[model samples]
Target: MGQLVNIAAHSFTAQDLLRMERVLLDALEFRVSNVTAFTALHLLVQGLPGTRPPVAALAVYLLELCLLDYTLLEVPPTHQAAAALLLAMHTHGTAGAQAPRLLRLARVEPAALARAAGRLVRIHRDAARPPTEALGALLAPIVSKYSRPSWCHAALCAPLDAVDPAWCSC
Candidate 1:
């Protein structure tokens, strides 16, 4: 039997997710990212187990997305990481645009989603120094936005009046 490597085991931090999201946005914000690119990114992230491994993919994919020829994205380990990196990618006004694609690709389990979100708190604690790039600047916000799953995001995204003190911080 295959030893299913649960992705949550090496969960990504909010800062990590944030940095990744920005790189994705930077790739997509301009003319770089379109629906096809978005879909491709979604396909990439779903295959990877969790958050951290995708960072390397984020860097690689960002370069590929900008360069225009994604043939290299088909390479072995790179393809795998790209899937995971893209899974966590986000942009303003298009935050959940790839949810359906991700759903189809990731088959996200409610338990896994919750577990991953719970793991976000850990990611937050670990992400002390973000990278010095466009993606680096986005670490705080994107992770804050998608660090948790929809259930967590709902409350995290909610107003301070509605938020609980404890879970909100980390």
Candidate 2:
């Protein structure tokens, strides 16, 4: 694990994100002194390391965010399309590239986001997380071009800006 973190830390090209990555990835478990145990527990439900398929990393990332914290997954539908655009290419019909990257990235691990992905299905009823004006700035362009989720018209209209470092590698 040290090797993995070291490699990721050194090669990690982003600058502003170092602090967030360190804090989030290194978040400690409340009950267990053993972070490894907690991670293992996370893997049990989420799958990690040898057990975790690379394909599922994205799905697992999102699902874990949802299961552990729903607020993290609460983005406007348009923003969701924009978020998908950030890291991947979407494949909706006639639409040249409207597929969400999460679908593609997580394609490596289909079942990981079983619920999180499903939740995307019912976006209108649910409120999105506060629009991180900083984050929205970054994703606006990508989302603009893509057809996005069929239901993303309302959510995708936020003004564009540079993507926030805290939200992604971008």
Best by TM-score: 1
lDDT of 1 by residue, 49-152 (tens): 44243343332333332232234333333233233233234311122434344444544443443333333322332232344465445455554544355323
- Model 1, residue 161: distance off in Å is 15
What C-alpha lDDT values do all the predictions have?
0.37, 0.33
Which candidate has the top score in lDDT?
1
The TM-score values for the models, in the order shown, are 0.27, 0.22
**Model 1 error, position 131 (Å):** 18
Q: Which clashing pairs does model 1 show?
A: 13-123, 18-139, 44-82, 44-83, 44-84, 45-83, 45-84
Error of 2 at 59 (Å): 14
- What local lDDT score does residue 25 receive in model 2, on the 0 to 100 scale? 63
